[model samples]
Target: MKTFKLLSPFVLLLILIVSCSSVSEPESAVNELQVSNSLTEVEVDSIASTLSLFPNGTQFSIAFISDTAVSFYGAHRIDDDLKNTDNHDRVFEIGSISKVLTSTLLAHAIHDSIIREDQTVRSALDIEMAGDPEFTFLQLANHTSGLPRLPGGYTLNFLWNMNNPYKNFDAQELKTYLKDDLIMPRDPGETHRYSNLGAGLLGLFLSELENSSYENLLQKKIFEPMDMSRSTTDREVIKDYLVTGLTKRGSSAKNWDMADLAGAGGVLSTAEDLSRFIQANFNPDDPVLSLQRDSTFQVNDSMDIAMGWFILNRDSGDRWYWHNGGTGGYRSSVVMDPEQKTGVVVLSNISAGHSEADKIDRLSFDLMKMHFAN
Candidate 1:
């Protein structure tokens, strides 16, 4: 729910213009019907090639849906001899994107009357606060909890083991940090500053409150109902199906295991399953996922972070909710235009290699504009 620090208003505006430009080109009245007919025959490969420009050695998959149909593209690495048979079902670690899922579970808990959005962190987790006691679940979900980006001792351990600094932290360590050494970067709810620690702690608290593991809670409330059969927290479940996540150079693959902080960077899913999730998000009436839109926390005067999803206002006055994820070798993104009844899900086995996630998000927007402009 934290606003991406790198996105400036001007940058977002530019991105919007570039993404939607094709939709606004004027068609001659004489040839309008002909142009529209030709547009439907546009090649998917052309779009795929445009997406390929951003990532290096990127093996990506995309799934998209509208009111009546679903489509898939680019299952390159997923089917090759480079990986095993279950590779198609292998769950790639979705990094920060896990935050969205964690946030959703928390929201569902709140909606179920199991927890309160305004509940103080201390009360929810039953621990002494080392910093601000006024912080609430909403603040944590929105990344305004003022908690440092990482635990206090993370840097000390990370200096020696950058690949697995967080691997050493457990619930006991987090509790100790909270009681003995935590500090807020600023006043809670002051501004948007992303904190993995904040989101991680939130997940811990939610799991404790529900009297169930975060993994189980998500399965019951989100995944199972949506029929995301291939999504799982157990690494072994997708072990044989796993795709090797490639580094930018395509030299080799790196696997990241965020043991205790699994809520922050755990869970693997396939493009097909993710597409279903995206569809449910856009059309909440599906009986699988329910989205409640409340303007409780506003971001940038117009947009809001509802539960774990982001609400963005388009130039045409339409709003969309979306999120993205990345880990060591994988990147993923989901976006939905609720008013237009359209959505997209993109997953890749390469990290930042070709900017695959961003390209898919842009292309989805372009496609949605074309679908809805009429």
Candidate 2:
């Protein structure tokens, strides 16, 4: 069993000593955390006050990142007190947001000529099994692969364990499930159907193509170039910096283990690293990011699914690309306008079951909209 390192008290003192601050400001977010000068003090207080409403032990890292400016905020609750946290580099599980990164890997593959978007899973895998699944790489990235949300017979396994549901289901097991129990519910790309199984399969195919594990591929292809040095899918590599996720009751929750389904929801990252990723989206010259952002499968008049993002068409003829994710003990939301070269990232240690979890997404969307308005 993995044991999470607790850093609350000692780390707090260390931050105090390092920052050269004597005491925490009372009752609000003006403590150890740093906010950039790009935002006015009034704007900072409003963001802080709104984030303070969550339950105790909830740590949040948020950023307003753009080509021209970067603003950040971090706060956490301890008992009845809300203290500003270091916004620069505290790692937390990003949940299904990993799908966005996984899809970027696919785009990277396409950029490298290792594969094409139209390639079917059957041909890619060299599997001649019956039923002949026709899901393609493009469909997997956009969640229209006609695959179920999860593999059959495993959704309810969380009844047995929740925090780390995928702990035992590894790659070999997934292969067995694909061969023995897999069934396509609809024809590939017939319609949009969000599927963790499909994304995981896409990750597996990418890994197989490179003869590498998913984590290794992410490092070589995505994280390193993007300078997301602290983000990773392997939990053990981040155990020291990993914040112990909190349950709804304000108690510690076990971290998740993705096993073979790491692609579905497994990466741990910090606000600083994630902001850099948003900056990369501002770069129109990067072929991989360009491809990921441009190839959209229209879901409706108001929305479209890109390689790993949802494009929300605003009434004002502008659009925002966004995605949100949650796991047993964490929730994340990110929204960005590449045209404006601005985005917001919200990461919290509060569980998805927490009553106030919706605030994370609300804050992200509202901040993005507000930036565009200004």
Clash numbers, per candidate: 7, 0
Q: In candidate 1, which residue ranges exceed 4 Å CA deviation?
A: 1-47, 54-57, 75-90, 153-165, 283-293, 353-374
> For candidate 2, lDDT tens digit of each residue in 1-374?
22222233323311211111111112122123343325444444455555566567888787777564456667677655666677557889998889999998999888888888788877777754337778788899898988888887878886578867887778788888877888888888899989988887788778888889999998887687666878998777777888778887778888888888888888899877787777777766666787889845889999998998999998988778888888888888988888876788889888887887887888787767665457
Evaluate model 1: give its lDDT: 0.61
Compared with the true structure, all predictions reach lDDT values of: 0.61, 0.75
Off by over 4 Å in 2: 1-37, 40-53, 128-130
Using TM-score as the measure, the top candidate is: 2
lDDT of 2 at 356: 76
